[model samples]
Target: MAIRVQLTERQAAAREEYESFTRQAVAPHADAWDRAERLPEEFLEEFAARGLLGAAVPAGYGGAELDPITFGLLNEELGRGCSSVRSLVTVHGMASYAVARWGGDRQREHWLPRFATGGAIGAFALTEPGAGSDVKALRTTARRTDDGFRLTGQKRWITFGQRADVYLLFARLDGREAAFLVPRDAPGLTVRPVTGMLGTKASMLAELSLVDCLVAPEALLGRPGFGLAAVAASALELGRYSVAWGCVGLAQACLDASLDHADRRETFGVRLRDHQLVQRMIADMATGTAAARLLCQQAGWLRQDRSTESLHATWLAKYHASRTAFRSASDAVQVHGAQGCGDGHPVQRYLRDAKVMEIIEGSTELQQTTIAESAYHSRTRTTPTERVTA
Candidate 1:
């Protein structure tokens, strides 16, 4: 946690500001929000007005347009306070990034301003009941029609779906994968709220049903067959980067909580921190948090460089950071003993939300494979002689 990522004075100031905001606006309410399973409508508006919801869009669109490192700081601090609030930032940025990169003029013009100005909340609707990590296996279909396309399918596990004003939905269009911008009020679209999750219960999750939903031709993002390879690929890459930083924040939070509890609690006439067992957990939590933060910063550097290697770096960061966050949360609960599992305890909530971090953006197992596969591919790109010379 002592390791700091190099930042400009402005960025450093921004990070401090984010920290102050989180301490004031998020930390105190996090547990209650989790129990309630929904954030107040006013909070969303304030979040958007503060430019957090549109952190990735261009300034012309009324967004803050933060760089990757700066954006990571924002996510990290917010994640430290409450992952459900951080979830909104991640998904909204993903959707904004997609439109900025892949959307046609009309699509961008129609959506980016609203998204950037807090006039709309955006969600990515790529996951299906059977296609959690398999983007290509989505069952949603968009049949080409005289006017535009007829969309019919279901999207499950959509974060902020219950309140999203727009969705960047993926479907098979004329037998090839495509992306479409579907407004919430589109004809034949239904949103069903989902609750009682293992974690992130306050994320406002929902299942979207598009029964013959219709969008004009302008709704299409890129050309047919480019959905998964380009739009979704780009979005998910940024997503991994954001989630990795968020996990770093979560880990740090757990470590801080554990440290405070050990200092304040005693057993058998000795402070908890005086016990070797508690000290060991604290040491592990601190080390893991530092390592995860470093990895996330490395990925952020690659992202800012616009390097091709950024994607794999993100895989590595996400894989390690998520595991560290979960492990840290588990130890935090252990340090608190029975009290940690009860109501009004933040550690209990952290434990649950950390589990969701390991699952979303990409599961821990999924990231391991992606990193290994990418490593082999990079190695194979060099000839045998070049490899040996290297």
Candidate 2:
């Protein structure tokens, strides 16, 4: 069944274009990409050709310059085709947003155009071995040099780390956290593939070792001592929102796949869809998928206006959508029974991909804590104000 969310004419057109593009360019090869454990490099060019590579970037920089709703739709459509492909947008957009938001004019002029055209692939590298969620605990260091900075650190779980032409790397400078734009070919820099993933196997995650990696003085993004907070405020917020929409697509995909199987496959006396138990599973999948999509749409609207409540809205959306996607995928496997467990079946891939969604960007536990803290503060603040007014 088609979703009924309202959209403006522009957003509707953009969404339709994305859907048509993914159906033709992505759906057919999604399984092959998963099985190969890699997204073909050629697809990046295809994304550039379709103007999906830079959905959030400004057109002045040669990007599509889409609005937040349209950007969310792009990710949703890509997510429906494959989670791995959606991840490409997540990391790349994170890097692009970082540069566009924090970089100096010279920096922006140099990198944004390249990112827009697929001339330079970008990856955000803030997660370290000891600092997955805790950015303050990062051991990466950037020491001042006569000409610039020499960075030394190791970053783990960096998506597209090996293949990316540039990385938005975080490190400590003079005891303050800072962000740097590091080129892949910098001396002493090493990007190694991290094999054996639970999901998103084709996202091309890597472990980066920066041993005295040198960068020019102009490579610093934003002023020193502000990088971590800037990333948390902007890049991470955008990331959670994007992930929520992607999860919506994931759940929707599970629902569509499950419904198709239930309608056709038969057992005992009639079609599987005729069985009451099968109908219950189908209903649950459909409801969860729709609910997740609605939450994501609400969050997308809040983001469009840059509302103060957008952060909490995004947290709620991501938390609910990711959990729903996982549950739906699990139930989908149950609906398909033995057929779902086979290597070639799409459900088997969906099962693996769903679990990773819970952990990436932010874990489920993290989202719960964030939501609770926001609610607690809001209630406490309002209580005192109401008492005084009364």
Which candidate's TM-score is highest? Answer: 1
lDDT of 1 by residue, 227-320 (tens): 5578888998888888899999999999999999999998999999999989999999999998888888888888888878778788888999
Cα-based lDDT for every prediction: 0.90, 0.86
Q: Candidate 2 on 124-172: residue-level lDDT in tens?
A: 8999989977777989999999989999989999988867999999899
Among residues 3 or more apart in sequence or in different chains, the pairs in candidate 1 whose N, CA or C atoms overlap within 3 Å are none
Clashing residue pairs for model 2: none
lDDT (C-alpha) at residue 30 in model 1: 91
Error of 2 at 294 (Å): 1.5
